[model samples]
Target: RTYAGLPVLGGDLIVHESASGASRSVDKATDADIEVTDTSAAIAPSGAERSALSAAQAAGDRKTGAEDAPRKVIWAATGKPVLAYETVVTGVRKDGTPSKLHVITDADSGRKLYEFQAVQNGTGTGQHNGKVTVGSVRSGSQWLLKDSARGGHRTYNLKHSWDETKKGSAFYDADNVWGNGKPTIAQTAAVDAHYGAAMTWDYYKKVLGRNGIKGNGKAAYSRVHFGDAYENAFWDDDCFCMTYGDGAGNKKPLTSLDVAGHEMSHGLTSATANLEYSGESGGLNEATSDIFGTAVEFYAKNAKDPGDYLIGEKIDINGDGTPLRYMDKPSKDGLSYDYWKSGVGNDDPHFTSGIANHFFYLLSEGS
Candidate 1:
């Protein structure tokens, strides 16, 4: 069954076969049969093609009325074969009867993860026997769970340290609140540290293939709300850590995803180009962070905050309201320049920074 433009992660064929039948999967489903209506319309990089979903069969004893286990298949995608994430469909059936949904990992390889069942929850024309999601997972890291309708929403947090040797962790005060003076769902410290750690780990592992912030494989520290009314977030080479300030007007926390990616990318820059923070090189330095920061956002693909060209729109750096910078047309912000020019001393990092910033945009987004 299809929901929205994204293809349901799994399909209904699981029902016709016996509950304990061998896993039979199909990778190619004709567009006509599925009736896929893509809504996101997100374009892929040049020459990139998407992988198709296959209907799989389960394995088990088929004779003597023995129940046959459900088949498993992996939603695999790789860098060479780039594809947008597939939308997985979930819900229940019409008669309030629960349908079994299984997630089998490593289906290609005989080494499969334990099969877990998912419950179906829906009724009438909208009724679906199983759930489907269009996403891929890392190999050797597969899981199976019962259909959701059988129980509650299953929430997961991927918390792997890209650099295991890195030490030091930041903590948040779950009960503390900032400017508004009201209690927060979580303390500022925890939020800042959580993102900082995740960014540092993901950047090194995914981009540079390095172990951690210090290619030597060491952990860094993060602190939030250093003092009253802090207005910026920064990383200090001396401290080898980062700090954030609560926004001045509203009680916005400074440890936003972009900010964290920005500050952390600085460490990456220092390690490589070591661009002097005073001239065009300096502008390149800042753009480096923006580029990687934006990349990280795209990699995450969080439903509420997917990737885009804009930077720091969440922080609200503009006193009135606007992103801190614009890659497509840097000058759109008025405070920053659009093109490069000679003698533009990096005196105003924000102003002299336009050229490289715009260049990175073109490189990533294309003209």
Candidate 2:
């Protein structure tokens, strides 16, 4: 609508006299127009699916048309119980992010309430005590690396394949135990990836008060061992998953805790401001990832992977003990700028991001 106003419902009948026809008559709704027959409250949001379906069946499929549980409500005008159901219709949002809707219905009459969809922020939350634990399930006799608690955030084995489109199989084990203190085995890296994801999810939920990466109660899956010694980790919007490469010679998997947090923050940024990945906004984009990544690492004080402001310290992308980017002194990388200059935006985002990274560091920690 152009603007919000009083919505007029079903008032079409109007007649004008032939002689001196100025404004003759209009048909208005009376008490009988909205009289409720069954004003009962028997069905709940769960069981109200039948009523929700009956209400929304005209728009979409009879069974699946009810996007959410029906909501019960009384006609405000009549001050009577006229339960109506408002279900979320099918459609992706403008930014292409998924939409969610909930519904409730009257208990007795089974009348559905009004349907609606809204962008609810921080709807879901996670709990991580900074411990090395995996949320998994038993299948037949094996335990799969799946986090049932945090929206089923799972880690898969790409088998050193480069196909990002394919979601590799789960890292299953006969015993629930995983890893042996090395990245040689597939499950070893899977644990790192899965655990890192859990920590990041927890950081966002507990510290930042976000539901998930998208703030939509959904988890982005992780793909480990994406390529042969690929030496890279990336978050793809298309796949909506984190892909980690086995570092040079397949010795190191780029599944560090801070790195996971950093990657997921990109999705967060996309869902929010959607800052363009170019110019000053691009640098801010990269800096946002680093900031939240470091925050997540700090929030998650796991002894194995302790918190630190240094980004990507465990992955060793530089072939030395040094991390990828330093927030305190980005110039240490030899390519990043310590401060923003007139032409800083022309440089690479990772390099130009040093300015913001340095600022966040100084602001958070002290000069």
Candidate 3:
């Protein structure tokens, strides 16, 4: 039972019923001397909503279009129980990804306490895992580049604009065969991305006995050509989408098969273990993605981009004709650690991930 929205547990007391129909006294798990000083809210609901919106906007660097009214609740997750407000703010981030931020605030002080984004991230199209079949939808005698077989997973062209509020146009073709195997054509990158998503979906389903990234048998979408000369791709948990950017000089797209697997694996990690993206946990998180990405590539058996232990080998992000990181000998990249050591958490996750990456390589292929 709650008192003034604060859980007081049977009005500061709980009666236990014995199997014999006898009543007994049990500890209520709260201090007996604790007093309910303020049963009413000091700040209005509007003030709480504003507090949440302000914090969401500041963190996302964009204006929130809508927000749910604050609801009075008990904030007893930690410390003394206190009256608090929970608000949800919705907006589009600066990177053209949708955001649904849940914010909690102190009821009396209206101070923001907690907030989390709700979108997803991933890989490139300028470089892909070679030729592969993709699911498409037919409408009005035209083939739309959509994965109807895989929960209607679709790809959109962002046109280098960060406006996720409005989805860009879907790629279409008469022949139903997409892409010319070159990044010069926009459809080329889209084809690669779509194919990669399909392959990743299949890898998880067929090999791991998992249904989808979230294990709910639902498909997540992808967005390509995100920004002008954008050099990276990412997943947004709020939007439940993966976005890719055209690489340097707009010549390379990062949508390789392993890249797709790598980015999408981040989603799986979020859904499962939810490792904190910092320090040792963060390194493990990144290494998990790399390990599964390599698994997906091998599972794909794509001839053009043969499966290898090298991550981002096709994208060539380094421009020196070297893959982003190596698993067999992680230190080959001169940044990632090849073995576990003390204080490895002090390094960035990408660098710290090398330790586990090397370990996986050894475990799979042997030293």
Each model's C-alpha lDDT?
0.47, 0.70, 0.79
Alpha-carbon runs more than 4 Å astray in model 2: 1-131
Against the correct fold, how does model 1 do in TM-score? 0.50
Candidate 2: tens digits of C-alpha lDDT, residues 1-367: 0001212222223455657777776554433344345545455555666555554444343224444444444433333435443345443334322333434344565544445443221111111212256667666567777775577788889999987789998777777777765765777777777877877887887677888988887999999889899988888889888998989888877888888889888888888979999999999999999999888888877776777778899888889889999999999989998997898899899999899999999999899
Task: Show the lowest summed lDDT stretch of 10 residues, model 1.
Answer: 123-132
TM-scores, all candidates, are: 0.50, 0.65, 0.65
Q: What C-alpha lDDT, on a 0 to 100 scale, does residue 251 get in candidate 2? A: 86
What lDDT would candidate 3 get against the real structure? 0.79
Tens-digit per-residue lDDT, 1-367, candidate 1: 4344233343333323446885555443222243322333243211011111111123221111102332222222211111133212222234323233343333222232333323322110100101112111112233221112211211111122232233323221122221121214223333333433454455566566876666665655555554455567777777676666556642555655667777878877887778888777777788888888777767655443457777777666665667788888988977777776767764577666777778878887788
> What's the candidate order when arranged by decreasing TM-score?
2, 3, 1
On lDDT, the candidate that comes out on top is 3
Off by over 4 Å in 1: 1-189
lDDT winner between candidates 2 and 3: 3
Clashes of 3: 17
Per-residue CA lDDT of candidate 3, range 84-152, in tens? 787878776686444667777888898887676543222223346555566675665787777754556
